[model samples]
Target: MTVETIDLDAAGVRALNRRLQGRDGPVAGGHFIVTNAKGRHALAVGLTEAMDVRIRGHVGYYCAGMNREADVTVEGNAGTGVAENLMSGTVRVTGDTSQSAGASGRGGLLVIEGSASARCGITMKGIDIVVGGSIGHMSAFMAQAGRLVVCGDAGAYLGDSIYEAEIFVRGRVESLGADCVEKDMGERAADGLQTLLERAGVAADAREFRRYGSARQLYNFRVDNAAAY
Candidate 1:
């Protein structure tokens, strides 16, 4: 396949995308290798089908937003919500990512080679996120189901108001959320983190990490905790 390189400022990029929609090329399943992208927002929005997109530089916001069955990889840092609402396939970031990476995603895997900011993987469902470095406060807040593996420390209020999701942190956690407690690191969790590390190409033992998740106490609203409500 002949890969096309589109060098554009933010406005030029949008114009090029609009022109692409008019062409007969397969917007859904076609492969797009984007380079020289200097933190442009909404890089690839609402793309469907089985596609492969490799971004060569940093992206500003909402890169690969609402992707479906598209394998997108960024070679640099991502601003925020790198893979929000991703349905399937994978989104891998080779460097650090900002806050809310992979927020409210349903399926697929998001791998960050470096650290992640606050609220990473918030309200996720069935998505697996693996971070090679530390995660900030409120990581995995209100997470429904899925797996989050952090190879480093997690900040305060980790897994606040979570439900059914599993979080593994290799370092210290400042505090656990309401009703959330530490559980014994079993074989299943270990194996899961190991598999994630292997998939993300991270070289670390899963046993080195500690696990945190929801207590299901805040799954529903209560009058006593009205401040949270």
Candidate 2:
């Protein structure tokens, strides 16, 4: 298949997004390459097609927010909220990302090859996130569902106020947040993690990681736990 190239400096983001979303006309599933993406915000937000898009440079906030069915890849670093609210498909970042990466994502796979800053995967509601490097403080705060796999160390307050979601960390965790506790990584869990790591193209042994999940302490509104509320 021929790869279509879109230059951000020449066409701009709005036009590029419109074409990718099929706003101009009927669009087919194909490969697209975006060049000269110099930290631009909202570069490819709200795309609903099943196209493969590769962004070649650093991008600003919300790089692929609300994406569905499209496979978006950022070859360089990403700013805050990368892949936020993604409903399906894959979003991969080859370099590091800033705060709130994959925040509120409902479904899909987010693969970050490098580290992520604070609040990565905050409020995630069923998306699978695999981070190859470390994550900063407050990662996965208020996560409702899905899985977060960190191949490297995690900073303070990991999985604070989590619910139902599972966190797998291969390296050290600085602290566990409210209602989050260490869970046993049984054989079944390890098997599942192995599949996820393969899907994310991460090379790591599932047995080397630890699992964490909600303690179910704050689920009921008991007056005794009012301080946590």
Candidate 3:
């Protein structure tokens, strides 16, 4: 493996990426480790190959955007939109993540070791998001289809405007969103959350979680209930 240690600077990181992009063959699949970094944003963006990128410190907004098949890991807290529009593979944050962590993601797995801010999985399509800590309000908002597992407290207005997505919360929820309600924790959900928690390395029982999801009330608009709008 060709190891490259990059400093946590915008220009230095950009130059490294440019150099990596120009490389051919197995060089693209080697390990790219970042050290002594601090709150840098968009550290790895638009990388198409399957590589392992490890960031040793805190990261700012959009740490990995439009990733195709790379596995990126962050050792510290991350800002908003940590893995936006991910296509495949996994992006794991070993610390807390901010709002819109996996917004509009299409595929892959996003594991957060700590709490996530509001809209944790907004508009998510097929990604499986597992949060070891609590999540903020409006989580799973307009989520078309995906699985979101929250091991801690969930904020208000959870799963608002959701569509065909499964949400499992292990802690108290302030409120449920429109067209969203709690369902009986079936064996499928239980098994699913167990797998997710195991993958995220969260030490929690899946049975302890309470499930919440769409009630299918607002799938279509109704003029008679316009007052509720």
lDDT of candidate 3 over 124-180, digit per residue (tens) = 998889998999999999988888998889999999988888899888999988888
User: Per-residue lDDT of 1-229 in model 1, one digit per residue for the tens?
Assistant: 7665556554366754553333446565566677777998877656666767788899889888787777888889999889988777888999999999999989888999889999999999989999888899888888889888988888889888888888888888999877667888899989978888898788999888887776556637455676674
When superposed on Cα atoms, how far off is each prediction in RMSD? 3.6, 2.5, 3.5
Q: Evaluated with TM-score, which candidate comes out highest?
A: 2
Q: Which ten residues in a row have the lowest lDDT in candidate 3?
A: 19-28
lDDT of 2: 0.95
* Residue 41 CA displacement from its true place in model 2, Å: 0.2
List where candidate 1 sits over 4 angstroms from the true fold.
Answer: 15-24, 27-29, 219-229
Candidate order (lDDT): 2, 3, 1
Among residues 3 or more apart in sequence or in different chains, the pairs in candidate 2 whose N, CA or C atoms overlap within 3 Å are: none
| Cα deviation of 221, candidate 3, in Å | 8.2
lDDT of 1: 0.82
How well does each candidate superpose onto the true structure, as a TM-score?
0.87, 0.95, 0.89
- Give the TM-score comparing model 1 with the true structure, all chains together: 0.87
Q: What do the candidate models score in CA lDDT, each in turn?
A: 0.82, 0.95, 0.84
For model 1, state the Cα shift of residue 194 in Å.
1.6
The ten-residue window of minimal lDDT in model 1 covers: 15-24
